[model samples]
Target: MRESRAKSVWLQREPSPAAAARVFCVPHAGCGTGVFRNWPPEHGPVDFLPVELPGRLSRFGETMPATFEELAADMIAGLERYMDVPFAFFGHCWSALLAYEATARLQRAGGPAAARLFVSSQLAPQDGPVGRMLGMDEAELAGELEAMIRDQGGTPHPELVAVYLRVLRADVEMSRRYVVPDPLRLTCPITAIGWSEDSEVRPGQMSGWPACGDTSFEVFAGRHNRFVDAPRELLTTLCAGMAGRGPSRLPVTSR
Candidate 1:
């Protein structure tokens, strides 16, 4: 029963037997594993695993975590079983904060540390919790959420939008309360990725990541949502980063 419950957070039940490494992808605010449905199963020797946080999708019945720390702890519990092999955590937007917290906590606890932490389109913890979403009113947020749904080629259903609004608001509040004035540096390396046209979190905002550890920065050409498509350049970076070959502090334009 315990094992089954732990597996609930992962969209993939079994780790790839032949994989040399794993990349656990955490969705952005108010989203679920389905965001990664278009991503390839394998990128070279690495397996892509999408995580499903509670209070959304299949885990909709579960209560949302009240704080980032609580959410990190829950993530650790769910991911513990899959950490035996070399693995990395990849998170975009708000989930990047959760990934950082989890990686920091794992190192402090003397647990199996992550090989790398890939934070995309988010400012470092010390620079946050700061984002445009935090300042938006409910009506504005609803409009943004609807826009997102429409962009994804889905018509916004009133009932679904209402449900997602609550989730988004909760996530925004959680992000607002997570101010890490002084962050714990991780033992593992970090790769801070920025989108060239990301209006939400500018590439310059991610410069503080070097203070987190042996950090590298990469800026890919596209908007904030481009990573959702798992573009070839992004996949190449993930695989190379795992093998310790990612470019250092230079932005690479992807065509």
Candidate 2:
């Protein structure tokens, strides 16, 4: 993979001539690809590509995507130029859903299909709208953020938290306005990973991933934002699952 920034996309790459696989990661809402900075380097032997959407980090001035379809389309168009290699996708939260749609679209367009899709810390695609947080005014949004921190168990550094809250507001607005244009289904075998304490996503919602495609679901023992809170364990489990077959743990059933 290579580093480039297009209309509304920011791309980062970890190149290796010996790399047998490439993983494209779509970050959670408000998060830049920076979140995966250490992933590629640490989990060697494969190339890692982190995708940056508009309105975050380097692409700060660009308009945030309003709907899921538009976001997926933008990603496909922006990154299709670099699709020569076999690849996979790892996405968190809303990005998981976005990645799923984009991959499905790519297959439909006769583009090369990815080897696997690792969706983490997100509700299943078939779950009813998971309720958006942007409808609240700034004050209400702050309160919601506090509640999220309490429920999710990880708070950014104090200074970082302040900046992230503003970014979070924009993310919420984008997520709130998002509408899916087609059936929320995928043909790829999607592995769904979520936090055990994530109240925002229920067991039923996680189990609904099968409705999206051939899926395997598992719950990590942590809060909603487990990716940030628990890095090594999460990444290792995620990469191992994607690189091989089956989840790190036994498949989960809906509660």
lDDT by residue (tens digit), candidate 1, 120-225: 9998899877888989999899998898887677888999999999999999999999989899988899999999899988888888887888888888899998
lDDT for model 2, on a 0 to 1 scale?
A: 0.67
Q: Which stretches of candidate 2 lie over 4 Å from their true place?
A: 1-9, 37-42, 132-135, 143-167, 179-184, 248-251
Q: What TM-score do all the candidates reach, one by one?
A: 0.94, 0.77
Itemize residue pairs with steric clashes in candidate 2.
Answer: none
Top lDDT prediction, candidate number: 1
Q: Work out how many backbone clashes candidate 2 has.
A: 0
lDDT of each structure?
A: 0.87, 0.67
Model 2 C-alpha lDDT per residue in residues 1-255, reported as the tens digit of each score: 854434334575434457666677787865676666556443655566788787767777777666777788888887776566657778878778778878878877778776677887666555535655645677676666565555454564556556667777767765655545344466667777877777666544666666666777766777666565436666666566557655634456555
Clash list (residue pairs), candidate 1: none
